[model samples]
Target: MPDYSFLNLSPAEFEVLTRDLLQKELGLHLESFTSGRDGGIDLRHSRSRKREVIVQCKRYTGFASLKANLEQEVEKVKKLKPERYIICTSVGLTPGQKNQLLTLFNPFILAPGDIFGRDDLNNLLSKFPEVERSHFKLWLSSTEILQRILHSKIYNQSAFEEEKIKETVRLFVSNDSFGDGLKLIERHRYLLISGSPGIGKTTLARVISYHYLANGYEDFIFLSGSIDEAYSLYNADRKQLFLFDDFLGKTFLHLKLGRNEDERIIRFIERIAKSDNKLLILTTREYILAQARLSYEVFEKPAIRLANCILDLEGYTKQVRSKILYNHIFFSNLDQAYIENLLEKSSYQRIIAHKNYSPRIIETVLENISTIRPEEFVSKFIGYLDYQDSIWKHVYESQITPFSQLILANLLTAGTPIAMNDLELLIRAFAERFASKYGIVYSQIAFNKAITELENTFIRSSRDSKDKLVIDYANPSIQDFLVTYLNDLQDMMGDVIDTACFFNQLVSFFAYEGPGTPSQRPRRTHLAVTPYLATKLVNRLTQNFVELPSSTLKKRLNSNTEPYYYQVRRSVYNKLNFLRHSNLYTNNIAMRNFTLEFFKLIMIPNHVQSEDIGHYVSLVIYFHNEIPFEEEKILAALAPNIETLSDYHDFKQLEALYTETYAKFISKSAAYKEAVRQMVDWEAENVDTLDIRDFVDDIHAIVDHTKIDLANVIIDLEEKFQERDRDYDPDEIYDHDEDVRSEYRAEEENISDMFDSLK
Candidate 1:
C-alpha cells in the first residue's frame, strides 16, 4: 500500500492522476479537457446521447478547503444536470463530511464511493498496481520512498538535493530510451549511453540510477576519476551500481585515455558481467566514443559494441517532447504572461518542430527568462532556438563575477580536470599579473572565494583516483560557450598567454601555421590569431626563453628534475617549427632573425631528443634551399641517435626524411637499415599481445621498403582470432540495432496517434 502525499504533483497533474484512477476503476475511457475554467467537467464519459457522466477533481491539502470549494461547485454542477457526478479530492474525507457532500449534490452523488477522497485513491492504486507505477511522481514522492532514496549513500555521492531530485522527476518525460536502457542493463549488467552534447545522456543515466536505487540496490557509486574506483568499491555480496559519466572525455583534447585505462575499463566490464549483484553505467559523447575506438584498441571489442545504447533525436517523439515542454513550463518561475505568449497560436509546436531543438537549450532559455521582457519571450526564445549557441551567453556575461570569469577562462586555457593545486597556482599568477587591470584586489581569500562561487554551475570539483582534488567544467556546453566567448576577445587571449605559467598552455591554446600543426588547433577551430596577437605570443616566448623564472619553470615541470632542460627543448622545437611555416616568422626579417638566434643558442648544443629529431630535420629540409645550414652539420647532429629510434612512428618520420632530397644519403646509411630491422623485429615479437589494426599500416610500409616477410605474424594473428571465434556462442549475441530500430518505429507511430487525441 502507498502512503502517497500527492504533494509532488501540480494541480493539473493531480487531475490527470485522478482521471486515470477512475477510468481504470470504472473500466471506461474518460475524455479530459485542457486546463482552464472547466465548468464542473474535469473528465467526461458518455454511454448515449442522453446519458453523460461528469467528474470534478479538486486537489486540496485540507478537508475544510475541499468542503468550502465543493459548496461553490454545487451550483455549477446543477446547470448541465448530468446523469451522474463524481468528486475526487486529495484531501482525506470523514464519513460526516462525505454525507454532508452527498446531501448537497443529493441525486447526482448517489453513493459514498461516488465521492473519492485521499484514502479512496490510495486504495484504488493498491488495486491497480500498474497504475500506481505509471504515475511515477505519485509513488516516488511518497514520504517513505523519498526517505529511502535520500538517505541512501548513493544520493550523497552525487550531491543532489532532495528538492532538486523532486523537481527533476517532475519535469522528466519517460521515453523508449529509459525502458531500453533498463533492459540492456538487466541483461548485461552494464550499459553505455552515448549521444551528442545536450541530448539528455546524463539525465537518462540519472533516472535509471535512481530507478535502481529505489529498488533493492543498496549502494550507488559515481566513478568521477578512474575505473579503479569501481573495482575498489565492488562488493559481490551486496547489490551495487556504478556510473562513470563522460567516461571517454568531454573535449577532444582530453580524449586520450590514461595509461592502460581502456584495458582496465574493459576488464571491469567483464567482471561486472559475471556478477549478478553489480551493474555499471557509462556515458560519453557519441563522437568521442568513435574517436576512442579509433585511438584505443580495447574499445573496439565486441562486448563494448553490445553495451552501446545510443540516444538520438528520433527517440524523442512528438508527444514525449510536448510533455517535456509542458512540464518545464508548468514548473518554471515564469509569470502567466510569458507562459501565455509561449502557448499562443501553437507557438510551442514550432519549438518542437525546430531543427535545433534540444532539452538543455530549452532549459537554459527558460531559466534565463528574467533577462527578456514578457512580450519578447517568444521571439527571443525562437531566436535562441535558431542560434542555440548563445543560450549560455547572457548568463555567462551578466550572472557571474569577473573573478569567476577569469577562473573559467584560465580553466579553459589550461584544459579541464586540472589539479586543484595547479589551478590555484595559475589563478594566483593571473591575479598578480592582471588583477589591477580589472580593478580587482588580489588576495588568497578572493581566489578561494571565486572557485567556491563557480562550483556546481560553471565548474565542479572532484578527487582523482589518488584522492587529489581536481576541477573541470560542470557541463561540456560551458566549455563550448567559453571557447566561443574567448575567441572573440583578442585582448583576453593575449592576457591568457601573457600570464601562462606552463609552456604547454601556449601550445594547447594557440597554434602557428604549419603542415605539422594539428587540425583541431585553436586557429582552425575557435580562435583566429591576429598578426598582432601572434607577434605578442612570439615576444612572450622569446622573453620566457631568456629570463623564465626558476620557480615558474619548476611549477610547470611534471615529475621531472631536469631543471629547465625540457622547457628549453620545447621552446626550440616550437620556435623552429614556427619559423619553418609561419609567414610572420619567415617574411618578417626582425622576427626571423630573433628566432634564428634563439634556435642557434638552444639547438647548436645538441639539446634535441631522438623522438624530436624529426622536427629538426623538417626545419632544415623545408628550408634547405632558403636557409644556409650545412647539410653535414644537420646530419652530424642527428646521425648518432638513428640507431636508438625503436618505435614505428620514429621510423615513419625517418622514412619521410629518406624520401626527400636525403633519400640517397639515408638509404646508404647502415644505422638507418638497422633501426628499420629492429622496429620490424619488435613488432614480430609482440604480435601476440598487440592489436594488428594499430600496426598493419606500419607493417605494410616497412615491408614495401625492406621486403621483410611478416606472413608468419599474420598467420599467428589469424589463428588466434579463429580460435576465439570457435569458442564463442552464436546464441549469446544480441542484435541491438535491428531491435532498436523496430521498437523506435513502433513507438513513434503509437505516440503520434496518442498525441493527436490530446490536440
Candidate 2:
C-alpha cells in the first residue's frame, strides 16, 4: 500500500531524471554530462540562458550526515563561481544536517531531507515507503540454501523427508514461549532485535527477508551492507524488507569515533529508523548485558522496539537442534538409524564450549560444511570450543574459574539461598534439554564447587531461619558482575564441576525408566533438586502466600519472624484446601506426598508456570480420546488460571513497599491459549501419538491472536494514557506545602526522635 521503494534509484538514473526535467521544462541544453571525480569539477557549458549545475552524490546506509561535507564542497565550488550546485544523497540528511546545509546560504538545491523542510521531506519519502508486511504476504519462501539443502534432504535425505522437516518445525515451535516473539513483530509499527553473538540473528533476518521477497510483495526492498555492492539500490524506487546484517557500523562500545564525521553518519541512520512505516531490520553481535531492560532512548538498548514489530532471536533449543540435525541429515545419507545414533550420542556442542555458543560460531561451522572436508566439519565443531584452546587456554589448562558462578547469577533471581543440590539439579536438567546445542558434560562437582563460591560471595545462614540460606535475588548488580566474568570462562569452569551427581541421576533413571521424549526422561521429583525449580517454588509461594491475608498469617505466626521462615503452619495449609480440587495442584500433591513420606520439605512449583502444561495437555487429550462436552468442562476447569486470576494479595502490612510481579497464571493466557488451541488442533487432526502433537495450524491461530491482542493492548493503553494526560494541570499538583502528601517534616521529626530514642 505504501510506496517504500527507496532502493530502486541509481545515481545516474536520478541524475537523468533531474536533468530531463530541467531540460524539458526550462529549455536548458548541456554540452555533456560528467560525474564522480576525486576532486574538482569538470563542466562544459555552451548555453547562456540555463545555468550549469555541479552535483555531488553520496550513496550509503550508515550515518548519512554528509550535508556538512557537501556544504564545504559547495563553498569550494562557490569560489569557482559555478552558477549552480546540487547535492543528492541515497538516504538523506538529518534535520541538523539540513540546518547545516542551509547555513551555507549557497545558491544550490539539496534534495530529500535537506531540500524539503521536515514533514515535506518526510512526506516526499512517504511517496515511496518501506515494507511493513509478512514474508508470507510477499509469497517469498526461504532462500537459505533452501533448494540446495532441501534437495540433499540431509535430515531426511534418504526418503520421505518433507514430512520429517515439517515434523521438526512443529517440534521446535511446540514450546509456546519460543514463538512469543513473532507476535511483537506482526503487531507493531516499528521493531528492533538484538541478541548475543551467533544467536541466529542473521539467519532469522535472512529467513524474514527472503521469505517476504519470495512472496511477490513489491512495496518492500531488501538491503544489507552487502547490498552496497549492487550500487543502484539506494534509489527512492526500492521499498520492501531491508535485512541488514552487521549494522550499527561502529565497532567497539568504549572506543570513540574517528572524527566529527562519524556523528553525521549516526544522525543519518537515526532519521531512517525514526521514520514511520519503514522497516529497517538490523543485527549486531556485541551489546552489554546491562542493556537487557528496554529503555525509552532508542540508542540505550541494543535491540529495537517501536510501534511496529519487535521479535528477538534466541538460538535453537534441544528440540530445534535435533530437528535441524534431522533436517540436514535427512536430506543426505543420514538414515533414521544413523540419525537416531547421532541423536542419542551427539551432545550439544556449545558455540562457546568454553563460554556460550553464539550464532556466529554455529554459522561458521555450518557454512564451512563440505562433502570434501570432513576435517573442516570437525574444526567447526571444535571451533564451538575455540576459546577453550585459544582464548582461555590457561584457564582450561588449570580449570580454576567457578562453574556455578558462571551460570549462577542467571540461574538465581528469586531472593532465596542457592542450595548445592538444587544448583546441581538445575545445571543437569537444563543441559539435557538442549543437550546437543552446547557441548556440556553432565556434572555435579561443578555445581558443588560453585556452591562453595556462592557461600563465600553471597550466602548467609542463620540457625533461626528455615532453609537457612539467605540470598537476595533483588540485588541483580552483583549477579550481573558474576555472570559477566563467569561466562567469560565457562568452558574452564565446566570441567571443575563434579559429574558424580549428574551420572548418579542418569544411572538411577536408566535403572527404572528408559530415556526418550519429555515423559520418558526421569521425572523431576525422582531426580536431584534443581535451582530453576527452586526459584519457581519461591516465585510460586510469593504468589500464593501473598494472596493470603497478612492479618490471618500474622495471627498464625504469633511471633517476630517472617511467615515463609516458619514451618508449614495452619495459615498456609488451610489455603491449600482451596487448591486441591484443581489439576494445577500437581506440585502441591507431590509436596504433600513427599512430606508425608519424609518429614520436612522444600518449595514446589505451581502447575500454572511450569512447562509441564504441554505434557499435561497431551495427557488430557490422550485420556479423553474425543473432545466431548464433559471432557471440555474437565479441561476448562483444569486450565491454567492465567486469565481468571483477579485478586493479588499483599503479605507486607501497615504501609507496604510496592513492586510489581505478574501472576504466572495471569501472564500465561497467550501461551496457554496456544497450548489449548494446539491441544484441540492436535485432537482434530491426525498427529503421531508417538510424538507430542506438533500442531502448526492451531499454533498459527494462537500466534495471530497474540499479535492482534498485543497491538490492540499497546495502542489502547497509549491512547488512554494520552487522553488522561490531556486534562492534566501540572501547576495544580505542584503540591501545597500543607498538602500533607509530602512526608518530609514528619519523616525528619521521626528520624530525630529515633536517634534520640537510640541515645
What is the TM-score of each predicted model, taking all chains together?
0.69, 0.25
Query: Residue 548 of model 2: what lDDT?
Result: 31
Runs of candidate 2 with Cα error greater than 4 angstroms are 1-190, 215-238, 258-277, 288-298, 301-312, 315-317, 332-341, 344-759
61 in model 1: Cα distance from truth in Å? 4.0
> Least lDDT summed over 10 consecutive residues: which range in candidate 2?
646-655
Alpha carbon lDDT of each predicted model: 0.67, 0.34
Question: Against the true structure, candidate 2 has what lDDT?
Answer: 0.34
What is candidate 1's local distance difference test score? 0.67
- lDDT per residue (tens digit) for residues 397-418 in model 2: 2333434433443342211333
Model 1: clashing residue pairs? Answer: none
